[model samples]
Target: MPKVLNITAARSRLTSLVQEAFLEQKRTLIGKHGVPMAALLPIREYEELLQDLEDLGDMLQAEQEYRRTGGKDFEDVVKKPKGRR
Candidate 1:
């Protein structure tokens, strides 16, 4: 696991901590009472992580809906669709 910093120390060096995360491509775990509360990560990584989560949710919903509708996969349902390339 990456090294962790307490809330007080993190507050004092927020700028450097952010710089370290960016420059070293490492995460800074911040927390209180020895329990991690949050993480400092590169902006791109954070955005990608969020997008991955959204994609996972989308896949799960699609699976549930397809089961309810008794539908096959899109490829099996259609030979070709309009305005899709």
Candidate 2:
């Protein structure tokens, strides 16, 4: 489960919070006025999340393009040889 920290508590323990986020791979949700506001996470974890999103986007785009192009198989589009070309 993720750790929840209020704004004032997060500010007061910024260093320790950062350490926990990095060394322990812990996620933190910062809240303000009793409402969730932001999160603090490790840079590596953020990078991995971005990479996963980009990969998913690429896959979806490829699928869309394939569907738009009549969805033909590769063998159906290959040119046939006529009497040894």
Candidate 3:
């Protein structure tokens, strides 16, 4: 489970909290009034998360472009006549 850190506590012990997240590879959730506000995670994890988001965005854009371009039928591209030059 992720560790919860209130805003004040996180501010007071920012260094330790960051170190703990890095060393343990655990998520640190910063909350305010019992509501989640932000998260602190290892840099590697953060980069992975960002990459996943970018991939998803690219996929969505491609799908939109395909739709706009009158998407091609898969069979038309894959079932070409073998003897055609």
lDDT of 2 by residue, 32-73 (tens): 766778989998999999999999999999889999986877
* Model 1 CA lDDT for position 42: 87
TM-score of each: 0.79, 0.75, 0.79
lDDT of 1 by residue, 1-85 (tens): 8777899999999999888878877788999987899999988899999999999999999999989999887787776677887
**Candidate 2 deviant stretches above 4 angstroms:** 73-85
What TM-score does prediction 2 earn?
Answer: 0.75
**What C-alpha lDDT values do all the predictions have?**
0.89, 0.87, 0.87
Task: Order the candidate numbers by lDDT, best to worst.
Answer: 1, 3, 2
lDDT of 3 by residue, 4-55 (tens): 6789999998998888879988678999876788998899999999999999
TM-score of 1: 0.79
Query: Model 3 Cα displacement at 16 (Å)?
Result: 1.2
